[model samples]
Target chain A: MIEEGAGQVDGTIRAVLRDVLGLTQDRVNAFDESTPLFGLLPELDSMAVAGVLTELEDRLGITIEDDEVDGEMLETFGKLAHFLRKKALL
Target chain B: MLRFGPQDGPVVIAAPALFEEANRTRAFLVRILRLLGVHGIAGALPDLPGQGESLLPTHQATLAGWRDAFATAARHVSAVATVSIRGGALVDGPAPVSALWRLSPITGAEQVKELWRIRQAAHDRPKLRYDPARFIAELDVEVAGNRLAPGLLAAMNIAEPSSDAPVRTVRLDTNPRPADLKLPGRPLWRASEPDVDEPLAQALADDIAAWVHACVA
Candidate 1:
């Protein structure tokens, strides 16, 4: 399993955010892990969430179950990274 | 006689589906094109409006509109074949297609059932149980939102083989691409292993390369 705090994890996550979701760097950095992502990002909705998840799945070779996450998990970057690390994305 | 130009290779065009499937698979599509190029297949995947980098058109394009893009692409590439997965089969005409390769083609109500079940599996996280009947009900709505008209919805139903067109299907095989992997949202270990063997991928690329080389020559 990949441990947390790997140097590239953060960059990979941020790249996934900007390139996959088409979000700006400032916008990605603006929100901490605790912020509500779906509503805050506006660009993120049910469909976008699925798209983003799909992009993450393909790029990272991870399996994100719809059942595993929720609106809260999506609320912040820290939370999502935690979920990823928990699932071993990091 | 077919012309052999740098860009004159088979073209791959796909239909627009809702949300993540399209985006996640975008890189995979481009990669396939590049691989085809290495094999002398040099293909092009045109952007359909409202999906990919294509401008988001407000007026929802119908099935025919999307098919027109494939026809347009086919016109440019003479000695060509077409490849598509899922909704892609719906586009363009017979495609003069040398081969119709769909990574995973949905051809029946079972596909509809599976789509809902998969998304519900993703949505109902903690529970982690698949409810087939309920999932199917939800899928109707999920797929419904993507299309604007009823006729188009029926038309987009990729299950109908006759509906896709009169093209000959060389190998209707389904091989999951890296596009099918589950990643960042979940974790690498949690995702399924790559479908084709690494050697197979290299070989598939090589095989196509030989064919394209022969055809181009």
Candidate 2:
């Protein structure tokens, strides 16, 4: 059950990035913990960051306070998922 | 006003999503209207005051004004149903249409939150915050480039999509909210630039056409 829940969180994060940034499924599927986001992905601009966060909130049924957002949370796909896992899985 | 499809029969008056979402999804909405025309359903998209080509300045627009304007437009078109996308749902509450169809409808509070988030993101300042109640009372408070009136912002904080008529809610499959139906599609409203999703448009048109038929039958 824990494994399934973790997978769901990971999948939700991937989908939010793909949908908000207009990334192809193949591109997002390739994302691992180390896959860099934020500064690296051209599509993940500042505006896109807001879209990503809001979409994540809507999909996961969680509230993300503005204070909780920071560069570290979005530096990599893994970190972002980790942040969401804490909020959603907890 | 943009009209499509047949000259007579059950007409649908569409309310495009508010603010930037409206610009991003205008083409997509137009495509849906055109497809609805092909389905033999007439569609009308009116320019709400202070939006589109209306002469009123953006800062002067109030939520009540938008609702009143939409109702008037629906009356003018003799619309049988009202179709709204996103924040557009907030504007159609008072229309006299027989049925209401909404795509990913959001409450006014959610809409305001999005605007503030966009503003914060644009400035790259995550800590920047405002007390919505107090902030809206200020003059010339612009969020994401649209100068908004205090009354509009205040009303939005408390407004929600109307449930007076039979309502059909459609959402993207990505959204977990309960909906009458959910369709697979990227959110055009979040696109960095204006874009079109023809397949999604086709799916929505089919859904709207079928729903309208069921409602009128």
Query: When superposed on Cα atoms, how far off is each prediction in RMSD?
Result: 10.1, 1.5
Query: What's each prediction's TM-score?
Result: 0.46, 0.95
Residue B64, model 2, lDDT = 89
Over 4 Å off, model 2? B126-131
lDDT of 1 by residue, A14-46 (tens): 756765456668877675667667677766655
Model 2 agreement with the true structure over B70-182: per-residue lDDT tens digits: 99999999998999999999999899977999999999889988888887777666475446666556666676777887678778889999988899999999898999999
Cα DockQ of the candidate 1 complex: 0.06
Candidate 2 docking band: medium
Identify the runs in model 1 with alpha carbons over 4 angstroms from their true place. A1-7, A29-31, B1-79, B83-96, B99-216
Winning model by lDDT = 2
What does the lDDT read for residue B215 in candidate 2? 88
TM score of chain A per candidate:
0.76, 0.96
In candidate 2, the residue pairs with backbone N, CA or C atoms under 3 Å apart (3 or more residues apart, or in different chains) clash, namely none
